[model samples]
Target: MYEFCPHCGLKYEVEPGYFYGAMFVSYAISGGVALVLGFILFYLAGDPGGWVYVAVIAPAMVLIAPVNFRFSRVLWLHYVAGIKYQPEL
Candidate 1:
């Protein structure tokens, strides 16, 4: 599975453990985006109850779960694949 690069089409083998980093990256991106959105809502609403923040942001985060999964896989492929393509003359 870790045998292809998505960006450049380069083929090289990589250890399975290498993908763990991509998972971290994906979680960080998703969580950070959700947190920021939560903060924005809090500010706009004059810092309402804590539940307000959770209620609004939790759904947004759930909505993004699928997208995050897909993004993580693509990122992993890019890192592992290390494959590059060249244009034909």
Candidate 2:
């Protein structure tokens, strides 16, 4: 079930125990987004007073949690599935 890198479109084989990198990528994206939002709120409020941003965006994040989960898997598979795409017949 080796795959290709979607970002770079590089075809490569997935080594044993290699899929874990996808989880890291997903977490990095999600957590980075949250942190950036938090920083912006704090900066604009002159303190941590703008919790409304967190309250609103946090739940939105939760709602999209499933999407994020699936996205990670799909991203990994895109790289590791080794499935090639061809134009329609």
Best lDDT goes to which candidate? 1
| Tens digits of lDDT, candidate 1, 1-89 | 43655655555435647567778878888889887987798778888888988888888889988888778767766765653445661
Residue 29, candidate 2: C-alpha displacement in angstroms: 2.0
**Where is model 1 poorest over a 10-residue stretch in terms of lDDT?**
80-89
At residue 81, what lDDT does model 1 achieve?
65
Best by TM-score: 1
Clashes of each: 5, 7
For each candidate, give its TM-score against the true structure: 0.66, 0.52
The residue ranges of model 2 lying beyond 4 angstroms of the native Cα positions read 1-21, 50-57
C-alpha lDDT of all candidate models, in order: 0.73, 0.69
Model 2 error, position 48 (Å)? 2.1
lDDT of 2 at 67: 80
How far out, in Å, is residue 44 in model 2?
A: 3.2
List pairs with backbone clashes in candidate 1: 4-81, 5-81, 8-83, 10-83, 10-84
Q: Rate residue 17 of model 1 by lDDT.
A: 73
Model 1, residue 84: distance off in Å is: 4.3
